[model samples]
Target: MKARIHITLKNGVLDPQGKAVAHALESLGYAGINDVRQGKYIEIDLAKNDADTTRETVERMCRDLLANTVIENFTVEVG
Candidate 1:
C-alpha cells in the first residue's frame, strides 16, 4: 500500500513563506497574484495490505508526527 499525505497550515495562521512567494510573484510581473499558501506533500510505501489498517496507521502518523495538529491539518490518500 501507498499513503500520500498533505499537510497545510490551518486558517488564521500567519504564513510568512507564503507571503514571500506572493511578493516575489508580483515582482516578476505575475499580476493578480492575490495570495499563496504553502504545504507539505509526503508519499510513504507500506508493507501492510489492509486498506483500513493502513489508513488508520497513516492517520496516526499524521496526528503524532507528520502534522502539527494545533496549527496544521492533514489529509491522507491510500492506494
Candidate 2:
C-alpha cells in the first residue's frame, strides 16, 4: 500500500515563504499572480493493504507529527 499526504496552512494563516516566492515571481516579471501558498507533500509506502486501515494510520501520523493541527490541515490518500 501507499499513502500520500498533503499538508498545508489553514486559511488566514501567514505564509512568509509563500510570500517570498510571490515577490520573487513579480520581480522576475510574472504578471497577474494573486497569491501563493506553500505546502508539504509526503509519500509513504506501507505493508498494510487495507485502504481504511492505511488511511487511519496515516491520519494518526499527521496528527502526531507530520502536521501542526493548530495551524495546518492535512489530507491522506491511500492506495
Off by over 4 Å in 2: none
lDDT of 1: 0.95
What would the per-residue lDDT of candidate 1 be over residues 1-79, giving only the tens digit for each residue? Answer: 9999999999999999999999999999899887899999999999999999999999999998889999999999999
Q: Each model's TM-score, in the order given?
A: 0.96, 0.98
Task: Write out the backbone clash pairs for model 2.
Answer: none
Residue 73 of model 2 has an lDDT of 97
Local accuracy of candidate 2 as per-residue lDDT tens digits, 1-79: 9999999999999999999999999999999999999999999999998999999999999999999999999999888
By TM-score, how accurate is candidate 2? 0.98
Residue 53 of model 2, lDDT score: 96
Ten contiguous residues with the weakest lDDT in model 2 = 70-79
